[model samples]
Target: MDATGDVILVQGGGSVAATRQTSRTMKRTANLQERLQEKSHAVGERADAVVAPLHGGAGGESELADKAGKSQMLEDASGNNVSLMRTMLRAMLHETSTQLMDEQKKMLERLWDALMGNQRMTTQMMGEQLEMVRQLQQEVQAVKTQAVEESRKVDELRRLHEQSTRQLRVMQEQTSEQIRTTREQTTEQLKIIREQTAQNFEQMRLQVMKEVGIV
Candidate 1:
């Protein structure tokens, strides 16, 4: 009996020691799992801190590119404005030159017209003077012809007057000679007639005395 009782006590004591050992191993495994979880969280925080600078650098570069693009656009707009102003000025100058040329052409045409009018007036006056000279020359020729005719008529009248004076002198000389001849003939005839009458009267007286015996 002592030997059996002693064996049972020993077995019970061994079982109790095995149970305490198992409880201690389970407590150690739990503490190790908590430590591993804490280590994983810390590693994730360290990786986030290292990649933060790369993201910030990329964002800053994008902002700088946007500002440069805006500056280039402003410069292009200013250049376009300068070109527009130059074009406008050139157009204005061309218009002014055209207007001046038109005015000069008009003035030249007016001057030409005036010169032509003056030339026509001068020609008309010259023609009038020539006509007047021709008329005066014709009148002078007519007067010269009239003077020649008058001189010829005066010469003819003087010749007729000289011939009439010579005929009158010859007739007066012939009449005086005829009257002297007639007076001589009449005296001779009267002498002869008186002689004959005296002879006849003497004869008749003698005859008468003888017949009467007293003579």
Candidate 2:
């Protein structure tokens, strides 16, 4: 087919492959985001539990009250620290996930570009190959035509040769017959002349004998 059509097919196949890869990357990214969100939620819940006020120890119990007071102060300090840590952890997870997704995006883009380049190269190679095949086919066709024409010419020459050969044979037979007829005619004329000469000599001898003889 045409180069444009082949290029379209290559591009179509490349796009499909790239799309599948992109979809997988997107799925992985979504999964990672979901997991990080769950982790952050868990951390938030734990921090809230730490910061929540403790129950019990209501009035008239000075020992219990003093113990509760000290425990409360320590817990408040620890809870604040845990909360701060949780916030930092959340920020870090968000930033890390964002960076990871951005990197994945860049990688997919590069892959897509690479695939397109390869497809274009493939299309060009295929076009060249097809063109070569077409040229070869045309050459083969021309060769076949030339061979046929040559064969026809050869056949015509053979026919003419055979005809000429037959005509020569006929002429030879006619010349040989004419020579035989002429030879026979010349032989018959010579035999007739010899017979007439012999008769004439016999008459002359008879006349001379008659004239010399006495009665």
TM-score of each model, in listed order: 0.36, 0.53
Which candidate comes out best when scored by TM-score? 2
lDDT for residue 54 in candidate 2, whole number 0-100? 38
For all candidates, the clash counts are 0, 0
Residue-level lDDT tens digits of model 1 in 13-84: 345533443344445445544654454455444444444445555687754654455445445544544454
Pairs that collide, model 2: none
lDDT of 2 by residue, 13-131 (tens): 35654455445545655665676566666655654464444333344465466556656765765576567566755765565456545656766898999999999999999999999
**Candidate 2 TM-score over all chains jointly:** 0.53
Error of 1 at 68 (Å): 12
Local error of candidate 2 at 28, Å?
Answer: 24
User: Model 2, residue 51: what's the lDDT?
Assistant: 41
Any idea what lDDT model 1 has? 0.55
